[model samples]
Target: MTAGSFLARLHGRTATGVPRWAVRVAYAISLTVLPSGLWRILSVDLRVPLMDAPTDGRPPPDWFGGEWWYVIGLSAVSETLAFLAVGLVCTWGEVWPRWIPWLRGRRVPILAAVIPAGVGATFNTLLWPYSMIMISLGRRVDGGGDLGLGTHGWQVFVFYASYWPLAAWGPLLGILTVHYYRRRKAAESVGVREDGARSPAVTVSH
Candidate 1:
């Protein structure tokens, strides 16, 4: 399906019945990462020196200013991963994609997605707050002093505004994950009850 149609299905416009807001939140998560990605891209592509020089007064690593590939690659990876959250509320999450030769159209075992996502959610949830706190304190969480972000006032504001959205990513992902789990469990329980009701009753012979 095209991306628009695929997104509609995830948003409860299709039969999946995932709440529209959940899909919106997933989309928001994707959007939230965009500004930061764009900023990084501009910094590297334009060679404008947007990021802070290191606090130690030593020259930054060669990769810092020279790595166009790193900037592009990192942005692509981050946004792509963020977009995956949309799958949680989509039908594709519960069924194998048609392109998969062996598992195509088969039911997805719920926990297969759940366990890894849950673990990731835990790490993600902890990450943003810590990072924000460190940023606010003007210290790198990795143990450095002020990054000397330079005197570009608007750039600093934009940088913080863009990056701050990331703080919501983990919490939103965790919420979506839980909602998916509960929805699948409820469906499974209904299926079990229906199956039980259809079974023939036992009878004893005298």
Candidate 2:
């Protein structure tokens, strides 16, 4: 299969009226956090030392030992959350998968997906800009002195490059959420079932 066809299959079936571009955007949103997640795994969990150690004989942070699990867990959790955006443009978001216990084969409540995603999108939209401003002013978002990544060329470049894609995360999620809302609303208006069947509309007699 061609690359385009492969991606189409991989993305699964989208809800009726969801534009092709929206499906691609949802997939892209899911990948925005990946570089930073991988960077954390490499630097902390694997102890690759992407940042410099203190020169004054200070010991490494607790994350190097007892707290190492936190680094791995954070990366895993963040990636999983980002990946959920894929469901926004796919059938799985409209209907719960059969593997789910009580919710299996049931139509998913629209608000159940929209509220959390909308909240997340709003939070991220504000967060990354604040972080960039703080960093630009030579202040850490956590109120620390320096990030220990050094002020020189390659270190700074690598650090920013790893996380820069996060700036797009919020906007992309917001777009996907809007598209999801519109598509689901259209489906509901016509009494369209998850499998594309249209139920007869009931008319109320005056």
Candidate 3:
């Protein structure tokens, strides 16, 4: 398939009647954490010194000592979680994929997808803003009061630019979850099964 065709299939509408915009948004959600994840890998694992080194004649933090495994693992897990948001707009979110043992091809319960995503959305929505607030107050949500970027304007700019996209992650996921819920609920209400077949309408004799 051509690239355009492949992309169309990837983001195409499924049985859920997801809008094209929503599919795009879901894809965007998967990318929201990428910058920060890459920043961590480059700064911590690769020791690219994105932040200023400590000036007190002390050695750098343990993370800067090439914590490749930890940094890579964290970034991997974060990106994987972000990618799960795509399921909200894909067929897999409504029906289990064929590879699963017993649940293969089974219709996924609505609550199964919504509850965790909803909870995650709520938590992330609160968490990032709270973190920014704490950072602004010169307090650290993760530990130290200082960000360790020192007084370099370029360093601060690059750091924030890499990390700022994270603030959109929660809101995007939340919106996508609501879209998933509405589409699925509408399908269920109209007796449309996961296969897109509608049940025969009932009639009452007068």
> What's the lDDT for all of these models?
0.72, 0.78, 0.79
lDDT of 2 by residue, 41-150 (tens): 77666766666656786644544345777877888888888878888977888889878999998999999999998998898888886776677566778767764444
Pitting candidate 1 against candidate 3, the one with the higher lDDT is 3
lDDT of 1 at 190: 57
Ranking by lDDT: 3, 2, 1
Q: C-alpha displacement of 155 in model 3, angstroms?
A: 1.8
TM for every model, in the order presented, reads 0.78, 0.84, 0.85
Q: Model 1, which residues run further than 4 Å from truth?
A: 1-6, 9-15, 48-65, 192-206
Q: Among these predicted structures, which one has the highest TM-score?
A: 3
Write the residue-wise lDDT of candidate 1 on 136-194 in tens digits: 66787786997455535676787788778888888888888898888778767655321
TM-score of model 1 vs. true structure? 0.78
Q: Supply candidate 3's per-residue lDDT for 22.
A: 87
Question: Candidate 3: RMSD over Cα atoms?
Answer: 3.0
* lDDT for each residue of candidate 3 in 78-154, tens digit (9 for 90 to 100): 88998888889878889998888899989999999999899988888888877766665566778576754442567
